[model samples]
Target chain A: MSQPDPLADFFAADAAPAVDRGFRMAVMEQVARRRLRVELALRSLATLLLFVGVALISPVLQRFAQLLGQDLSQVLLVMLAAGLVAYLGHFWLTRKPVLRLPHLRFF
Target chain B: MSTPPTDAALVAAARSGSDAAFARIVDRYQGPIRTFLRRLGPYTSDADDLAQETFLTGWTELRGLREPARLKSWLFSIAWRKAKGEARTMARNRQRDHDWQEIRPDCETPETERAIALHQALAQLPPDQRAAVSLCLGDGWTHADAAGVLDMPLGTVKSHVLRGRTRLVEILGVDS
Candidate 1:
């Protein structure tokens, strides 16, 4: 008896109609847009956190100045700016070389 | 000299907020993703929905991937899970029907008919066995690759293929 070619038959039977490239492009575009929105949202949240942190701390420093009798606001502003610079430096360092990683060899 | 970026390159770019890089990933894997979904028994309409969800989940979770070279397997693993979940939901909704007509195609050449029969025989096997056979025969995945994709032990995957192939040969009335 002949050995039937199951794999050949399977491929022939499963050959679907060609997909519309335009439809595929549209789907990719939708995904891209969604990713963009997510990144934007993350950046916006980071900015908001930075602003809120500074805003809340500024008033506290001003109140402390009344008790200490020193120009604590100027000192606080410089410290805040310096801290922001350090944070930016850390972000830059972490963001560098964001692409290279070891490939998984699962074969 | 900077070499042209590969798919992994594009994926990294996407992870770091590059829209174009993300689009590249979507473009590259869409066909394979769609084919995988189709084989999992989803109708074309529902296949599209599941495909979208698969890519979306992959995009959101790409950062967790330790090895970018295994991207195809990773994507397939996600697609497999999504398809299985959908199948379970579908089975619950249509519990009364023993025979699922979705397994048959409208147009059938003699070759196509035999292929459908083979698929039907395959569907009768357990999910892991069916998956091992499909990945090996349909997707051209090696036994080890199929094992990784299915999260099964290599020996388990080999057994599934051996048993699944034996059953397929029997149902197709082919001599080994």
Candidate 2:
């Protein structure tokens, strides 16, 4: 006859809980949120690059506009300011407080 | 009717960014992963969070997994690491606060009472020995397979299982 082992019996009888759809849904939701964050980050990087490219070429464009009797610096300044505000606002609304830079850190 | 795809096939599809394939993988492995974490000691309260982190890490690092055939052991390895990290973090927190306490598992019934006794006995063991017992004796994993998951040597795993079981039997025997 087999020996009675309570330890083995205890382990053997420990049934796993039934499959929970809620758990899967929670995980999938996290995966979707992560994908969205990556997409937003990539789009933000592209926008920043576009802004830098525009700023780099602005001096040349301003010279052309001066010859045409017009000033372009004010408009470029306004566009740059708007982009900075939008970027800061997005960062403020979405990112965790810990992710903020030291200057902007809010504990 | 079609047979379900194997874990390797699911892993390949997941690495290709198929959400459906990844969900299938989560559904397939979540039970075992969660159960293992619950048995892993002290952090049973964080079992769900730990399991979610394991799957998330698995998803992010799926492409880095060299052998698709070893997905089960790989996921278990991730679970073990996550549990260990959580334990360290909790230990640090516990030290900071003299009043720290682990969140107790629900124990309203006779069965749960017995489970609580087992958990208490298991907690008395060193962490590695507890894990060895949980993997080998509790989950019925082979010693070699458990060693692979734990990254311990075969002989060490065997020694841990033997000693852990003996200690557990002594503890539970006294309790009963």
Top model number, DockQ: 1
DockQ of each: 0.16, 0.15
> What C-alpha RMSD separates each model from the true structure?
8.6, 9.5
The residue-by-residue lDDT of candidate 2 on A1-107, one tens digit each, is: 96566686666444346466888888888887777777677777777998999999999987887775534567767888998888788779877443442231110
Task: Choose the strongest candidate by TM-score.
Answer: 2
What does the lDDT read for residue B52 in candidate 2? 87
TM-score to true structure, per model: 0.66, 0.73
Window of ten residues with lowest summed lDDT in model 1 chain A = A98-107
Backbone clash pairs for candidate 1 read none
Task: Give per-residue lDDT, candidate 2, residue B42.
Answer: 47
Cα DockQ of the candidate 2 complex:
0.15
User: Which regions of candidate 2 are displaced past 4 Å?
Assistant: A1-5, A13-15, A54-107, B92-110, B174-176
